[model samples]
Target: MKQVHLAAILCLGFIPYSLTACHAQNKTSQELNKSPEAANSTSETVTTPSSTQIQQAYKVNNIAEFNEPWAITPLKDGRLLVTERKGRLYLFDPETKKKTEIKGTPKVAYGGQGGLGDVALHPDFANTPWIYLSYAEQGQGGYGAVVIRGKLDLKQSTPQLTQIEKIWTQVPKFSSGQGHYGHRIVFGPDGKLWISSGERQQFDPAQDMKSNAGKIIRLNDDGSIPADNPFMNQGEIAQQVWSLGHRNPLGMAFDPKGQLWVIEMGPKGGDELNKIIKAKNYGYPLVSNGDHYDGKPIPDHSTRPEFEAPVLDWTPVISPSDLNFYTGKMFPQWQNKAIATGLSSKAIIIIDTMQQPAKEVQRLDMKARIRGAVQAQDGGIWVIEDGPQARLLKFTAL
Candidate 1:
């Protein structure tokens, strides 16, 4: 074990925020408040400042390393089930520093943005041992995100998944593009399975409720449509649409207040953090705080009043991936706050959730492309870096 020291304080009103009702007291980045057009209405120009020195506020231990590790689901028995982008699952024991490959996993397409993704245990896992997995499954047209549930047996000599059943798959159609598989599957407080299905870089589909692409789908644990789903009886569109108009959502988690938050990748700039609401349209291709990769300007969110604007928009895109709410005792100051990792930023952003819409307060540079982050059973923050040699890194207060 190593001891690391980070200089942290419970600073209030840290930086100026763009989210409505948030007031930024100081300029944290070069472009903040630089846009004359962005100063009006529900949106404001907020940018992250350069990385600051932490010297090491926490010690880091490489618990386990895997090839392109995607998500970390901490097991109750001091073990972890980690998914690799190559369609494999492993039982990792941090105490033993050993990793054992699970016997079965769905055969993923194993390419750009396709493969194994998020994994989560059923809330009643102690009794049922049901495990849910999201991945890029081969569909008829093209690859689309799919979710499945199975019984996980780790006590046996050979840990494996059995009695597996298909729970849900993206609706309407699949896509030819390999990237933008918005496949974060999480169970909220209501026991409903909420899923994020990306647009696969397809623009118009996000705005079309008839197409399931670029929408969040909610379902019962058994993959059946809930009786009270927002779109339950509105024809084909009633099949599964929970919230519409998203581009490439990668992270989703519930805050202590029971609010579900999502972080998504945008085009050239304008990565977003949004508070999700049932039946709300998020305005993807129609409006964006960012422009197209070709340098073409897309209308900003202020142009549309009906769509739910992002609580925060990253002008210099962060490529955010995983989200974890801090509830551990290790970071008392961060209890119930939102912590997120990003690929392009190579940092973990700490946001203050005490506001109407969450506000970014601090950016801790992790010095790597962080893929997944979760709070461990022991109150430690566990994160996996992105790469063939991706490592499960643990962060604990000194």
Candidate 2:
């Protein structure tokens, strides 16, 4: 393991920002005011000044490498499960530095931001051993995100998924384009399955209750609609919705207090960090701190009081990829905080979610497009880089 030095403090200042859409490939890319129109509302921006000083914060170990690696999670037995964007899965043993490819990952519609996505273990995995996966698939219209689960059979010579079953799917496959398929999935503390389905870059669907796009979905662990879901009476499609009006909500996590939060990519500016509320409308296409790619202006959240506003937003988009709340002993200072991986910003943003309105406190520069970050069993952090030949890095105390 090599000791990595991280800049401890980054002095804040204003910098000009240009808006552009970013994907896995090349695309060029916060604080203080509480006002929705205040583009500088972020307590700090991820764009660090060149004069910032550096210091050692943690020792980083390159655990393994994968092609276009996306999400990662630790298993009960100390092994790690990682997903590759091109429809592949690997079971990695950290202690042995060995990676075993797990078979049976469904073929994905792998192109233009659509591919294998998040991987999560069943909350009751010790007994059930069910593993869940989210990915993009090609259909009649175009492409859409889908979630599936299966029992992980490890006793065989090759670890593979069995009895795979589809749990949820983004209805009405979008023909708009191949962007913003937010297939992020998480199991809430209440044992309900939660999913963030992006609007597929289509404006109107975010506010359309008839479609499941651009909404947060909640369901029973077995893929059945929960009786108490906020929109149970809306329709079969709306029955799965927990909340509506979101853009590309790529990350979601529950804090120590069990409150859920999401980090999503905003337009040219206005990346958002939202505290999700059940059945609330986040006012995406209708209202945003950002504007359309064509430079069309969208009203600020402040203009619409009925719609929910983000607790924190960034002027120069962070292009946040994934999120995890720190609840570990290794980094006491980061305890109960939100760790958001940045793609365009190329850093790990640490936010104080416990505050009245969550604010960014620090950024750990990785100098690479970060796809995801998760807590290790020992209270350290495992970070994955984006795109081809991506490295899986483990971060522990210095």
Candidate 3:
């Protein structure tokens, strides 16, 4: 097994992950009042500033429009393949502002946070044009998240999907309204697909090896487990199990050095950014930086030295949704920095990496719930907003 060393460099002063139970506390009507700025309103106001006023040296340019876009991936041909939560995939040409919806996607359960999720092109897409997708499917018990693969038929004006096949499905198919199906997919350097599964708020299932509910699963392109998978020999352990003990992991990506990193949401506090390792357990229900909403105490990561700890974590909850590492030339200063979008904190957090572990350097408060951020082929940064009337925006140095 390959090992990556992680060391704590910059301490943000201890922000305890444990919090007092707010369950019995009366739900104040004021708590229902949404912040005017965070409220979802459809207004086409072009707020542009003098180029010189841009301090971070980047400007946001609205590139295209979509209906609740969840993820975007840049193709080798410079076009972007964007996925909408309505079980539709579209091809967006930034140069021409042309958008065409691809047909032939599997049926998706689109409602209350469950729908078409992440879409990633295969690493060898230039030759294969194979695209991978994660979405909520109505199954035996209820709705569960599923990962599938299909070929993109780009020869037509409106591209379509062909050869569609379901690769993996979360077991037990139980639905709990808003399932935390943390469906982010990425193709690793080894050509295996790494998927982050949310615990569906079931808690105990996160530690279950037989169930695939809350685990980081590694699978071949065709959705089969690699024979050499760490738990392949264990009968009860799912062959797809790469690591266990995860809650709602929304952010996942690889650095230039080939290390896999993941960010997951903690209870009330204790949102974590972890460096993923093979078969290493990340303390969840047993040990966490945060306590249960019912005020039950959970052990801290320190309590179990055997389980791996997050390299960095955020108190008060950043609600990190997506992760990307800057490898482009536009922001030379941000080279190798891990860029994460904060959904609750409404910021784009940049973590600077040294020789060992990475540390948070700056948290740029966009004042918008950033759902996804990716480095464009041209070195610019592209970000997608989280709800209805979401705009696909591009950021370039001013």
Candidate 4:
């Protein structure tokens, strides 16, 4: 794999709130007003350009680099833990600018969107030293995303995983090579593990409670379903489902006030940022702001107000990948803002939540396919790129 120097890429400063710039240049009012079928037909013919030529903010800098870095999390000692799509985890020291490959990760099925995905620290990591990982496990005829928890041993010259246990798995895996395995793992404030499973590109499975393919699943720290779960009493519905009707949700995080938030990719042009509530069904195939890739119409969320609506929706989707709520001292002005990594837009979107009905405050384009972002203990923001030549980048206020 090719490796690029971190300093080669530029780092754009945050756009002040006063700027009213919009990122959806290709989408027009006519397209937005068109019927779903008509809109879908037009979008099918409109090809999207790759990141190499996409326009972005001209001022961002890349601080560090990595190989196909997919997820990034901070350790207690101020070092960063990054995961590669090929199944290797690494320790990146910012001060020393060094990288150490970790050992003992489970073998992964790493090809065509399946691989070792998100890595996160346990909520009580300081006391337990436990870390959670989500990856695509190859078995039988295909692959499925699985979640595992293990202890990280840094005592050795190179850190390694120990006591790795499979906590959850997607049952009845499909053969589709490009299914959206939305495999992000987060620890809710209630000490429950919340995971977003994609619909596996199957429209019908999302509405099927019997299948775990497309649901937000909740489990206890030990991978057991909580007795008080919304569907615990239901005979057939999986006891682990917290909510349903999600398509390729890549980002999930909890705000300071304990509100659980998620962002998922829509079919044609509807990207959504939703605040997840207990037992609430966010309409998916039944209703979407975007249309199908084959130019088919899906109902709009406005038609079904009973289902939870996204707090914010993007018409020409930015392909949001990672989500983080900023509450650090390095940028006090950005406190309580939602920082999202953008793949299609090649930027970091800052949504200011301090105000009622949070809005996209700024879109600071980094000119790279940003995959994951996390706030460091000292308040600096860290981001990872999503490519074979991905890099670990840090952002500081100018």
Candidate 5:
């Protein structure tokens, strides 16, 4: 077991609407985009105000560290399941500051944003103890994202996966650069599994109904498509699509109203926060608030009346990694607020999603690139940092 070191702690009153400039070099070492200079610019800053007056204090505690951790989900018991980018899963105990590696993980295409991604427990986890995972895998053509679920066999000392079965696989794997395999998974309120499939940095596939890439998919727990899906009659591939034309949707969450919202990184500046509607087309590649990496300008969403527009978009780019609505009673002030972890910005930007145009109310300045966050069973938040030797932090109301 490795020793857990406590880092500098932060305890502060909730402040309103302030953000530091993100790092100019937005891409990571293993990021598909080699030219870090071509990422987003760090010049502009936008501050949005909050309507709430109640201020709550919270403290941050450095829990544990992992190698390039991607996503984390809380177990019923006070433990957590975390996924590392390079094909590893961990069962972490926050109290003991100890971690146990889980076995039976699939081989991933590990590089440049392709690897083991999101981890989610089935809604009926207590009775079934099933776990869902999303990762990138290679085939004849290239690598694509896929979803798998297996029962967690905890009877033994070491946790292991049993009855492993792949549920969904992206269509038409491309040999293009290995990036944008957005495989975030969450079970909706209706008990349907929802997944975000990135377009593999391919422009046209976002609009191509023949491919499942660059789309939101809805399916049953057994990997079967829902009969009432919008494109059920369109074709085999289109039948799984719940929404289309997404660029690199990494973060997704359902509000208390059961409405889904997504956060995606833009090419240069325009990071987006969109309210996802069923069967709607969010114009990507064709229309964006930002331009191409090479300075090629794409039309703004306003130009396209047919396509759906984001409720709010960021010009300077937060490079959001994950989204979760704070429902825990610990942070009463943040109830129902959306917490978006940032990569380039290195902050946790909290937004009031219930507003007409979602407004960012608070920005917790974490010096490290934040990856994934989930509410703890005790109404706290567990956040994982990015890259090797990153820290796992926990926040609780003070």
Candidate 6:
């Protein structure tokens, strides 16, 4: 297997408000206007470069470096909490150049693609000090993705997690392979929690109504099931399901218009960018633009009109890791663009979503396997790269 450092925060302590317990998801990514579909698509094709060469934009500033960092989350006070794959969470201040290891972080599997994953702040962090985390855990299945909720107390010289509790986990637990533990967690437009549960390389479960694997789920902050979920009529597994049929989904965020979008790693050449709809099936193993590793062909989305297809996809593959929509004043011209990191392509992808069938306006060559992307509180784009000694970089106007 190849070695990589994959990529975390919501710390804007604003006015405390009570959520009526009904719902939540506002994550910013690039903006795009959809108007047309061709071939097997339901809409018009987003422009593909006639020339396969990538265009570079923006210079990178090496803010700091760490060992295999997985996520980069920002607090309102401009402090960053970064998680490493080997089970360490560090609170970093880009301004102060300080790094403090956060205690009480859960132990991670650290095998293949498994390990400590995403960390996000509660949507209402001002009132509630809850912090959400997703990581690979040892259980009935050889290893499974797990989501846990906790409160991080940073009052003292040391920071640590308190009131920790499990929010979600992969059912039937064991996976034969540890390469696909997709545990990206994002809050939707509603107040509910949305989790990307990978298929665990177990193809059939992506379409299984009885399993949480390969499904996008909705949950209350306290780990309770939401009442209005689409699959609530079914058994336990289906009750929390919001959408089904996915591979290893990592990048999940809602655009300004409240539309949920996710980027999934497809087998071979079919990496996909999808607009997530409630209860929709995003044909994974059954249908994809890419095929099996052995070169076996899977039917395209056109073969199944019942399935939802990708808004855009990569043929040569970029190995997309994290997602961020630029809405800050620091990079004014980059506003409304979905900025994502490409591991294989060694570039930063900037998608122009405002145009009909969003275009890949820029691909900044970073010369490293970029793993995570986030817009920091200081209005700079922060990213973490792959491997030990990986650098946390800040990108601004050249």
Clash count for each candidate, listed in order shown? 4, 9, 0, 7, 0, 33
Stretches of candidate 4 above 4 Å error? 1-61, 235-237
TM-score of candidate 1 to 2 decimals: 0.85
Worst 10 residues of 2 by lDDT: 30-39
TM for candidate 5 is: 0.88
Q: Model 2, range 1-398, lDDT digits (tens) per residue?
A: 11112223453233323112222221322111111112222122233332232222455666677788878998767789999988999999999988899998898998778889999888989789899999999988889999999889866679999899999989889876877889999999999899999989887888999989999999888899999989888899999998999999999999988999999988767788999998999998888887777778889888999999999887656789999998988877778889998887777788888777677776665557788999999888898888776777887885
Ranking by lDDT: 5, 2, 1, 3, 6, 4
1-398: candidate 6 lDDT, tens digit per residue:
21111110011111122111110111111111111111121111122121222332344566788887789899899899898888988899888899999899898888778889999889998788889989998876478989998898777699889989987888857758886677888887687788888898888889999889998888998878988889888998899899999998888887777778788888866778888888899988898877777768888777898899887777666777887788887766567778877676655677766666665665554446778989877777887887777778776654
Off by over 4 Å in 3: 1-56, 355-357
How would you encode candidate 3's per-residue C-alpha lDDT over 56-174 as one tens digit per residue? 34555766667777899987677888888888788889999988888998899987668899999888886888899999888788877899899987878867889899888887677
Per-model TM values vs. the true structure: 0.85, 0.87, 0.86, 0.85, 0.88, 0.85
The residue pairs found clashing in candidate 5 are none
Cα displacement (angstroms), candidate 6, residue 364, comes to 1.0
lDDT, residue 259, candidate 3: 89
Residue 237 in model 5: lDDT: 93
Best by lDDT: 5
lDDT of 5 by residue, 257-289 (tens): 899999998777678888999999999978888
Compared with the true structure, all predictions reach lDDT values of: 0.75, 0.80, 0.75, 0.74, 0.81, 0.74
- Stretches off by above 4 angstroms in model 5 are 1-56
lDDT winner, 2 or 6 = 2
lDDT of 4 by residue, 263-285 (tens): 88888777888888888888888
Could you give the candidate ranking by TM-score, starting with the highest?
5, 2, 3, 1, 6, 4
